[model samples]
Target: MKIDIAELIIVEGKDDVSALKRAVNADIIITNGLGLTKERLKEIETIAKDRGVIVFTDPDYPGSKIRNILKGRIPNCKHAYLNKSEAINPKTGKYGVEYAKPEAIVRALKNAKATVQDGSENYTLTDLVCWRLAGADSQKRREALCNHLRIGQANAKGLLNKLNAYQIPRAEIECFLAEYERGER
Candidate 1:
């Protein structure tokens, strides 16, 4: 199906933009994950405020971070985490949705939801960040967070917000893993 360009803002890399252009007619923007400039952010913010901004980032850490950054900046930006399952070479785990077929993109958007937030819980940011970086089972991650932080699900979410606000270092992800593992016993 052909998607119209008038209402959606497609956020992706240049190649993804190219693929998206080929797949459907959409207003697309490219961000190389170096973060957006204030001017660009403003333009995007303005467009997003008035229309729909669909964040179509690569399914990886940097891409995930870009989505997170945009969530904080864009007022009405909706995010679509491209399913790696849709890529032609799905097992390679590479970047860019350029390799994904048009059907995959469409399916992803159809199922896309509004931004997922940590909400107004009392948990620390560290807990949330750790949970994300752990690459463990969700039940395991939540259990670990609860066990280590001694906080309920409500507070665990707040911890995630706090961590995001503080800008946790990527290098320190290991520290969180260590702490979380230690707390398991």
Candidate 2:
């Protein structure tokens, strides 16, 4: 399926550009991994202000770091999330958007979430613990929450920051936790 996206997608590398080309017809900017310079960021800012941006980084630490940086610089940027499982290259055991199937890419792009710039503190670390997103044996739950919320996986603190940064309401989180409990039970 071909998607016509008006905003330019910001990815980590050329491989990601290639993968996205197969899934949709849209303009893309390559950040060359964590090597994003101020000049490049300026260019990205220009494009983001003019046409908007969708950040589609890899599902790894570096990817999260890059996404955070972009979010800090460009508020209200859209985010496309692909699960780590979907991004794993079967042959190399590496993870990246380039390794994901075109269909998965299409799905992620279609469901991209826009950042909510509203300064609402809707959650705390205690909420993360209560939701099984922190403490021992929480990795699985954290991953599940990330997938459900489409926010990408992160450690407890990072998850809390993302939850607030995206302005996810406490009620929504409660619903997800309730559903997760039901599924686990």
Who wins the TM-score comparison? 2
Ten contiguous residues with the weakest lDDT in model 1: 114-123
Off by over 4 Å in 2: 113-185
TM-score of 2: 0.60
Shift of residue 158 alpha carbon in model 2, Å: 42
Instruction: Estimate TM-scores for all models.
Output: 0.54, 0.60
Across residues 1-185, which tens digit of lDDT does each residue of candidate 2 receive?
46656667999999999999998767788999999999999988876765589999999999999999999999879999999999998889999999999999888987884332233356888878877789999998888888887777899999987776455667877887788888951
Per-candidate alpha-carbon RMSD to the true structure: 16.9, 17.6
lDDT of 2 at 47: 67
Give the per-residue lDDT of model 1 (tens digit) for 1-185.
46544345456567787777766655577775656778777767766754558888878777777788888887467776676666546566575688878877766765675332333333345545545633344556555544554434534445464344323353554465667678734
Q: In model 1, which residue pairs have backbone atoms overlapping below 3 Å?
A: 123-155, 123-158, 123-159, 124-159, 125-159, 125-163
